[model samples]
Target: MFLLFSCSGAFSEVVMAREKATGKMVAIKCIPKKALKGKETSIENEIAVLRKIKHENIVALEDIYESSNHLYLIMQLVSGGELFDRIVEKGFYTEMDASRLIRQVLDAVNYLHSMGIVHRDLKPENLLYFSPDDESKIMISDFGLSKMEGTGDVMATACGTPGYVAPEVLAQKPYSKAVDCWSIGVIAYILLCGYPPFYDENDSKLFEQILKADYEFDAPYWDDISDSAKDFISCLMEKDPEKRFTCDQALEHPWIAGDTALCKNIHESVSRQMRKNFAKSKWRVSRRDVIFLYHILPKTNSIAAATLHCHGHPHGD
Candidate 1:
C-alpha cells in the first residue's frame, strides 16, 4: 500500500493509495470507529446508499475494510481537481460552458432523487473530475451529509454548507430532495456571476438574506448574461420549495434546452470576480458559520429554534 496524498475532514481522513496487486490508484477514507460510536448508523446508511448508486456522475465505492479501530472505504480516484478550480483555470469560460456542466449535475441529481436519496449537501467542492483530462466527467463526492429518504419521508436535519444551504433547511422545516435543487440554484448563480448570491461577514445576516431569497444579477457582472439563464436560475432559486423547478423542469428550461448560443467567453469577468471573492475572508467566514450552524445548533432544539428565528427566507426541493 503506497501512500500518495492525504486530506483531512471533520469526520474522516482520505488517503490516496496504489493497490499492489492491480497497481490501481484508489482513495481510502479512514474513519475512526470511536468517532462513530453513537453515529454508527450514519456510516451504515452512507455505505448502503453508495453501494446502490452507480451513476456516471457519482463517485463509486469499490471496497470496504474494517478494523477494531477504524473503517476504511476504498473509493474511485478522481484526480481532475474541483469544479471551481477548473473554471478559474480556464482562459475562455462561457454561459454555454456553465450550462453543460450544470446539465451534468442535474442529471446526477435527478438520478439520486429517483432513487429516493437526497444529497443534502451539493456544493462545488463536492464536485470532482474523474481525471486531469479535458473531457473528464464530473463526479459528485462527499456523502457524509447525505440522506437516504424513503418515499414521502421528509428530512428534518438542517445540515449543509452555508450559502448553498436551502432556506427551508435553515428554517428548521421538514425538507425533501428540493434542498439539493436549491443548492444547485446557488451553484448556478455563482457560475454565472462568479460570486455567491447571499454573502455577509455575519452569519445571521447571511441566513436572513438566504431566507428572503435576496439575490440579483447585478450590473456589469450580469450585463452580458442572457435572460434565459437568469430565468432558469430564478425558477430554481424560488423561495417556495414547491414553486422551485424540479430537476426535470430545470433541464427543460429554455436556457438549457433552447437553441441559445452559450459558447461566449465569460472567463475575463467570472475569473476576476472569483479570484477577488475567494481571496477575501467572506468565503472562509461563511464556511465556518455554516459548519457551526449545521453541526452544533441542530443538536439542540432551543438553540436551533432561536437561530431559525433570526430571519425569514425561502427554499425548495
Candidate 2:
C-alpha cells in the first residue's frame, strides 16, 4: 500500500509514496505501459545499470514492480530539491561551497567510471539534494542515459542534454567515460558563474559551439572567480577528450583538494544569475528526443530516430 502524492514532471509521474508495510517513504516512478512501447530495451538497460550501482551520492533504485498496465520503479526519496535551488536559498555561497559540491559529484562519477559505467547525462536538473537539511549531500539521479562499458559495444550514441553534453557527443565522435568528465567541467563552470559554458538560442549554433569547445570566462561574471577554479574547469572542458581531466585528476586539483577554492561569499551575484538564467521554460528544456530526432539521428546512423524517442532517451529524464 502506498499513498501517491503530486506528479513531479510531465514526462513521467514521479510521485512521493509512503510504504504501508514498513512505514518508509520513497519515490515511485510510474510509467504507463502504453508509453513504453518500442522502448522496452531502454527501460531494461536503465534497470540493469541502476541495479549494478551502489554509491552514497547516487540515487538508489530500491525495487521494481510490474502491474497489468504499468511499470513501477521504487526509488530513494530525495526531498532537498535541486542543486541550484539549494544554492539560491543559501545566504552565503562561495567557491569552496561549489568545489565541495563538485568534489562529491566527481567522487561519485569516479566510482561509476571504475565500474565501466558512464553517466551520459549529468546536468543540474539531475543533481538533487539527499534530504531537507543544511548538510544534505548531493545525489545524482536519472540513469536512463547511462551506459556500461566492456559490453562489447562502442559508446557512440549522440546522447545527453545539449547545453551540458560533451564536445565529442555533439561531434558524433566515439567517446568514453571522459564525456562524463566534460559534463563535470560544464557543471563546475555553471556552479561558479551561475550559467552554462556554451549557449546559443539556435540549436545548431549551440552544437557548433560545443563542438568547438567555444566558451569564455567572460568579464564581470568571472572577475571574482579564482584562477584555479577557471583552470580546473578548463582542464575538464578541454576540446580534446584525450586531454580532458579525469575525475581522479580533477579531484586532485588545487580547487578541490588544496586551498585554491576561495571562501569569499558569492551568493548574491551567483544566485541572481542562476535565478535569471535558469527560470522555468527558459533553460530547462526537456526535449532531448527532439534533438535526437532532428540532429543526432541524421549524423549518426547507428541508432534509429524513432527508437530514440523512447522514455530512455538520454537527453533528459
TM-score of each: 0.85, 0.88
- Candidate RMSDs in order: 10.3, 9.5
lDDT of each structure? 0.76, 0.81
Best by TM-score: 2
lDDT of 1 by residue, 1-317 (tens): 43323333345665555665566666666666766676776778778888989999998888888777777788877778778778899888889888888999999999999998998889876877777778778888867667778745568977888889999999999988898999999999899888999988799999999999999889988999988889889999999999999999998988788767367799989988888886565463222101101112223222121111111111222
Report the number of the highest-lDDT candidate: 2
Local lDDT at 112 for model 2: 98
Query: CA shift at 233, candidate 1, in angstroms?
Result: 0.3
Candidate 1 similarity to native, TM-score: 0.85
In angstroms, give how far residue 306 of model 1 lies from its true place: 44
> What total of clashing residue pairs does each candidate reach?
7, 0
Per-residue accuracy of model 2 over 77-164 as CA lDDT, tens digit each: 7778788988999999999999999999999999999999998988888888887789899999888888889988888888888888
> Candidate 2 — what's its lDDT?
0.81
